[model samples]
Target: MSAPSVPPQSDGGQSGRPGRKPGPISDGVGPTHRAWLEPLRTRFLAGGLTISDLSERSGWAKSKISELLRGAGLYPRWEITHGLLQVLEIPTWPMRRLWMAAALEAHKKPDWIDGCIQKVALTTGPVEPPLEHQAFTDLNRDAYTAYARVFLEDQEAFEAVQETFDLLWLHWHEALASSDVVAFAWPVLRERVMDRAYHSEDGHPELTHAAFNTLALSHLTDDDARFRQIAESLALFRAISRLPAPQLDVMVLTHLLGLDHAAVADVLGTPIAAVHSTDRYARKSLTTVLGPQHDPGDAPA
Candidate 1:
């Protein structure tokens, strides 16, 4: 929570890559985290909370707070970071959610995460920004939001859509030759969100440090009443986002996006039976999360 002691001359002692070191800086703060928190640091300083003041308020040992902000090769605790957000007096729950997501995503690569952040951050513009990225968001933006909305918050959802468009942008010629942008792009978009939502480097959580554990951000519980209400309510957006990462891809593809079981399987690169099982589990989990209002059978199970 301590404000970064960044002088005007430097980008907080990190002109380009914030926590980057010589020769790749193994486990350093990636671009996504730096992009996400740099603004917070600026606002924190603007609010007149000096580094010492934030350190005092966070009540975290100076070392812990520094580690959190510097964010060198750590997954970051929801409890600790959320506490700092509270102390910093950052406005809005969405921003907190963004921080939570970026922190979580930051544990991996920065390129995609930072790209998604930029996309969501630029909401309320172009349907699809042109090829040069000079104007307009792009036509495929809607498709990303529609599918990605399942795995991400509203803001992140939009960014996910943009990421999908980024794929479309990359493979424009291939898609043209394939004569099916849907087939070509959907698989890429679907897997991108899925891998980011779940799977770590080895399809399992990697131990970053002994003292701290990587807390998976998905899964709903009684403790999530506020967010759960958002899940339960008619807000289709929140409902999808609240589901566990695995369930989200299946449910969103099979239900919300109107893809059939086989199509879901294709997008997931799994068998038809696996898709059905995932779909059933997702609906059942929704029933539990929604508790009475939702009927698992209402889904294709």
Candidate 2:
């Protein structure tokens, strides 16, 4: 372990205050990250420590210390921030919360954050993730992955779910603070999946990619019949994707992911009634968009 940085002493070998404080944090530092940065700056100034002192004491480069103080350059990893906080005698618990909130705001992946924290060992001990977080991940990982797989390849879908869980873990406290954890966490998962979803020219997630892979097309042996099925399937996919988010989610969870209405309700943290209503709206809207079928039973399941 590194020796704690000592504040310069006064004329009588008493602790002396720094002559000047560090400059104001730039406006560019986001509010969440700035919240954490301010205390580090305040503690450093109060300790009468110089950049060189922090650098030497923490075993960090002088340039790194300067950037951290000035809020310049890329957002730093938790490992470096934690080390500096220790050297400055700041309580890690409070700053850890603030650091996490900032990290979430920075849009870092969970693995990236975890890898960074693991890089540096601290006497305070390794960071323990919240216990409920593990439970949450276990419960929802498969459902989220299944939903994501509708639009993404298997590995991409898995990665999207992984990122979502990581984000939820990072903001676990905030998620708990919200009216409903599902309400908060679902949007995070949805955003992660949609970010990697295929988008049409207007930037909406469109299912045009899934059109050719339908079971209906596989059953059609004639070239003309297959081509017609392809066209209708394309139209259906576009309609399904263009539905409002709630309706679209219900359709995907129920029809595409093979989850039941109760299961969809459970996953979305919504009432069964809401899921049923949304499903009705989605099917009705599809019917409206595609026009009434001569034989409703012939519609693709």
Candidate 3:
């Protein structure tokens, strides 16, 4: 089954534009996030579970609960969301895990990592401080889970996240030395995945089975254009994965990691020209695979 459809985040009032489209909240996944969370909000109201009840059960402040429900903060924390679920006597173990997974990703910037970055990024490199300079802060369950989801799927991913952070916990100072922690997250997480995939010798079944250069993929299904867009995105990602390693790496660094050409060149230890060439090839191949006149407007906003 498909996920629920979310209404536009804005009605274009803020932009003062008549026909401009609404944008996603973060990573262009706002619709999916709102779709799942909104229903829970509805249930909370329908069940007559007031702020006092949730506050009493969860031990979180009423203002915090109110802000979360109203979508006031960066993103709702999983613990808070889980607390609300328990207040409603809902079981979160098996079925709601997927929904919770999606909700948890919103926790990335909201939690510990964001604050530490400011302190660490200001410094040139690792430096000894007045015995009080902390090496690393803790990773919450939500952020830990999202890190693994960057690569792996299901139970193995969970285990990988646990093991990976435990190791990172060993060398926390290195993260503190990075020029940009936001940029650092992608590589650090992906390296853990690369290690796991290499050590265990697991094959990427998704890429082997996926097809991008097909007309059927290019054509939107009549039943639901929205759903078709989601399918196209999956296909596009898979196709990118199947590109030659250099091209794939460059494309992923540029688009997926939100890196600039200079950063890509730095990461890959390649010249700027190679970065440009690889990106050009990647785009041209994707455009061909997506078919002539394939509009990327349908992609996430």
- TM-scores of the models, in the order given: 0.33, 0.62, 0.33
User: lDDT per residue, candidate 1, 1-301, as tens digits?
Assistant: 2112222222244223233211222356543444345545555544545455556777766566666666644655555565566566443243444554555555535654454445433222234434543222353455456666544556655655544444344335445566444555666565445544433444532112210111221333556753554433343334445566567667656665677888666555567898788777777777666675665334321
lDDT string, candidate 3, 177-261, tens digits? 6564333443444444444442212343232222232334457556586456557667776666667656766655566545679
The whole-model lDDT of each prediction reads 0.50, 0.72, 0.49
Clashing residue pairs in candidate 2, if any? none
Count of backbone clashes, every candidate in sequence: 10, 0, 0
Q: Rank candidates by lDDT, best first.
A: 2, 1, 3
- Candidate 2 lDDT tens digits, 1-301: 1111223223234365564455778778864565557657766876666787778778888887788888888788777798897777665654666676567677888787778767866565226557887888889888998888878888768766866665565456667877877767787788768866878887778776566765678788999999888888777778888888898888878876667899998899899999989988888898898887522224343
TM-score of 1: 0.33
Locate the minimum summed-lDDT window of 10 residues in model 2. Answer: 1-10
Better of 2 and 3 by lDDT: 2
Task: Please tell me which model should have the higher TM-score, number 2 or number 3.
Answer: 2
* CA-only RMSD, every prediction: 16.9, 10.1, 20.3
Cα error, residue 25 of model 2, in Å, equals: 16
